[model samples]
Target chain A: MTRYLLRRVWYMLITLFIIATFSFFLMKILPGSPLNAEDKLSEEQKEIILEKYGLNDPIPVQYAKYLGGLVKGDLGVSFKFDNTPVTAILFDRIGPSALLGFQALVVGSILGIFLGLMASIFRNSPIDFSSTIIAVIGTSIPSFVFAGLLQYVFAVKLGWFPVALWGEFEHTILPTIALAIHPMATAARFTRTEMVEVLHSNYIITARAKGVSESGIILKHGLRNALIPLITVLGPMAVGLMTGSMVIEQIFAIPGIGEQFVTSVMVNDYPTIMGTTLLFAFGFIVIILIIDLLYGLIDPRIRLAGGK
Target chain B: MSKLLEVKDLKVSFNTYNGEVHAVRGVTFDLNKGETLAIVGESGSGKSVTSNAIMRLLPEPHGFIKEGQILLEGVDLAKKTSKEMQKIRGKDISMVFQDPMSSLNPTMKIGNQIMEGLIKHQNMNKQEARKTALELLTLVGIPRPDVRINQYPHQFSGGMRQRVVVAIALACNPKILIADEPTTALDVTIQAQILELMKSIQQKTDSAIIFITHDLGVVANVADRVAVMYAGKIVEIGTVDDIFYNPKHPYTWGLIGSMPTLDSTDEELFAIPGSPPNMLTPPVGDAFAPRNQFALEIDTVMEPPMFKVSDTHYAATWLLHEDAPKIEPPAAVKHRMQGFAQTGTKGGGKR
Candidate 1:
């Protein structure tokens, strides 16, 4: 297992390398020079600015320097943000984004699994019908629209919450819901389908024949098997939650990595853009690896014999 | 012999989209204490359904016992509430299913799976249950029970998993054990071992067993009384010797004739003609009439009542009527019966 994990980590590093190389060069290839806004200054001043940021160097030389700095754990300085190290900026913003993402995931997963189990247990009943309706509504409405509507009703109309900010736990309510709604719906739908399928499995009939209670058959047998498929979805869902949160963060004026990343892109802040994009890619890859490891633990067939 | 379980005119049906499907029609039988009764039938012959109905384990919204009295030790089991039935299941009765691998939960340790009943029904604590689980595993012939008990179902071989399932069924020491095709999924060698194990276990526990299967070989080895189900009802029921030699039902004759014997050099084994009737719109009269070559004219218009063949044997066939012509069994079946008699394996109908 250790060897297998080591192989996976090596593969992940190679993937990261490809992503970093592409994003770095892709940013360079985009129209509009980083020094375009320097028209307000003299040509000599512009040249000085270009020299300071190493823009005058050839692309390959700059790429080599960037790669060296990356190896040394130096992400250089943000061009638009008063020359602060891109890593520092990222660290500052990541806390809120991580907290928000974590909150969304925990809340979404708990509710999804609960409603999914309920939907399966009371299949073809009002509970299932209502859950399907809620999932449809949750998935159909855009996160930004939901965020805007939630802010208007809960914050502006009724004055129950602060409209836009990320100061306290309370401030995260609307944006987190906006970010979580769709993925929560998707997870719930998947869980319901998988649980229903597991409940109908031949093993469940055997369990029942063994005189196991209905609840015992479901909680102990059905849920564990159903969780395998649900676990696979969690990896991509986490990435989607973080990436999808950019819009919600912008709407709520939250100081999160998603917000910072978006701002960096509009102004072409090279260091910030590279750092955040790399961070996103890293987060996605690492979560997927953890999910793969979890699969081996949950299922003995997979653990004894590695994934086929 | 004292009765262990009795079913009176048990009828089970499924409400399908098209109409009601009579899965088990007027099936009735009795299991004696400490005796193995085999319910022999083809698939969908209502053998499994009858067993499931007795346990009240049938899937709802589709399967239901329409009319019946499943009496266990004089108590009508069909009348018991779900909660009341729960008390009886795994405590007074236990069942081992066909597929051993699927019978045990994949995620659970073998010890935990065995101990679940001990903890739930026997009221034993975790430590006590674990110790008993290990002992049960050892009794079932699992090697290194201490270490193996911690292992999950996937770690064990197919034969070993069947042993684990047996160990679980024996955990509660149920008075009545139902093994539905327990050896059907196993190879011949493993099947023999399991049959021997069940026989020995029965001797030790003295529990009545309802062994449901389609294998006559298995029935011959393990069954004391045989109940042959064709459609949803018992076509013939008698002592094992009577079923093999003096069988009265045509379905039983077909079943016995279909068996491949070591001495026989026939090109192809005899197969009963025509498929089983569709249960959706079940036949108006005898369900097996279409497939029985010896079926009389009355067999097509009316269902036959169980006619007494002996003090302990009975068969449902128009041919068994007193006025009906006496017909002889096929030469092959008669030859096998004569061989069986020559071997002196036929004991009088007394245990």
Candidate 2:
């Protein structure tokens, strides 16, 4: 198992290298540069700025410098934010986004899975119908719309939560709900489909014939199998949530990496973009790794099949 | 022996989009304590449906007992609430199904699967359950029960997994056991071993078994009584010897003849002509009339009542009526019956 994990980690490193290389080249190839795009700077002033950030160096030399800096945990200075070190700016913003992402993930997953299971169990009933309707609306409508509706209803009309901004736990509630809605709905829909399929499986029928209680059958036999397929969606789904949260974070003025990442992108701030993009890619790879490990833990068949 | 289970005019139907498919139409049979009654039929003949109905384990909202009484020891199981059925299932009755790979939960340890019924129905605590689970694994001939108990179902081979499933069904020592084609998914040699294992287990526990199968070959020593089902009804039912040696219904004759016996030297194997009648709109008279070459005119017009053939044998066929012309069984069947009587491999049915 450790060997398997180590192998995945090796693969992740290679992936990050490829991503770092491409993003760097893509930034260079674009018609603008951080220094070149500054219209007010004179030719000599632009040259000085370019020299300071190694922009005057050849493309290969710059690429080599970038690679060396990456090895030492450096991501250059952010031109978009008063020439701040990209790493320092990202570190400062990581906590808020992580906090928001973590809460949204936990809340959305638990609630969505619970609701989906209910829909599956009480299938065709009123509760099942309503949860399905909620799930459909959740999947069909975009998160930004949900954010607006939530702000309009909960913030403007009810005055339940503060309209926008992040820091206070209360402030995080509305944005989290908006960010969480899509995942929660997606989770619900997937869980319902998978749970219904699992419930109809032979082993579930065996459990029922074994005289297992309704709750026991649904929980132990049915739910475990149902949850296996959910893992596949969750890894990419987490990545999507992180990237998707940039909009939510911006809308709510969450002061997270997402806010920094977007501002950097608009100004063509290559280093900050590279740093943030790498973080997301790393998170995506690690999340997928964890999910793969979880598959083996949940089902020995997966492990054994891989072993063979 | 006391009557362990009785089904009176039990009819099961599936409400499909087309219409109500009469799966089991007014099938009646009784299982005595310690006896093995094999319900033999082709697929969709309602053999499995009948067994599932008895346990109230039929697929919900559609598959259900349309009309019948599934009486367990004189207490009507059909009248019992689903909650009550829960108590009866695994405690008073248990089931071992087809497909060992599927019958046991894949994620669960073999020991835990066996112990699930024990913990729930027998009220065994965790420790007690674990111990019983180990013992059950051992009982079912699983090697290294201690180690085996910790392993998941996938670790075991198909035959070994089936042994675990049987152990699970036998966990609470239910009075009645329903084995729905338990050996159908197994290899031929493995099939014999499972059947043998079940028979020995039955001897030890004395649980009345309703063994459902399509293979008549498996019925010889395993079954005490055999019911031949066709178009959702039992066309003939008798002691194993009666069915094997003196089968009265043409359908039963066809079933036996279709099987390749040791003495079957003929190059071209006999097959029953035509497929089973569709149960959507069951035939007006005898459901098997279309397939039976010896089918009388009355068989097409009206369903034949169960005619007494002997003390223990009964057949639903107009040929058994006194007024009907005396038409003997096929030449191959009569010869085989005589050969079986002389060999005495199957107990002679008053030869």
True contacts kept of each: 0.49, 0.73
Tens-digit lDDT string for candidate 2 (A121-217): 9998998999999999988998989888889999999999999987689998999899888879888999999999898888887888888889999
How would you encode candidate 2's per-residue C-alpha lDDT over B1-351 as one tens digit per residue? 788788999999999999999999999999999999999988889998898899898887788878889888799988887888888888888899899988788888878888888888888899999998888888889889889899989889999999998998999988999999998999988988898899888889888999999987777758899999998999999998899888999888888767766657763455788998888999899998888888889988999999999988999999988899999888767766676677764432222
Q: A1-308 in candidate 1: lDDT tens per residue?
A: 66777888999989888888999999899997766766688899888888999999999999999989988888899999999999999989989888888889888888888888899999999999999887888789888998999999999999988999889889988788877888788778988999999898767776676678888988998999888888898778888787788988899999999899898888888988999888899998999888877877888777734343
Which candidate leads in TM-score?
Answer: 2
Task: Give Cα-based local distance difference scores for all models.
Answer: 0.86, 0.87
The prediction achieving the highest DockQ against the true structure is 2
Off by over 4 Å in 2: A304-308, B342-351
| TM-score of each candidate's B chain against the true B chain | 0.96, 0.96
Compute the DockQ of candidate 1. Answer: 0.63
Q: Indicate the docking level reached by candidate 1.
A: medium
Judged by DockQ cut-offs, the docking class of candidate 2 is medium
Judged by whole-model lDDT over C-alpha atoms, candidate 2 comes out at 0.87
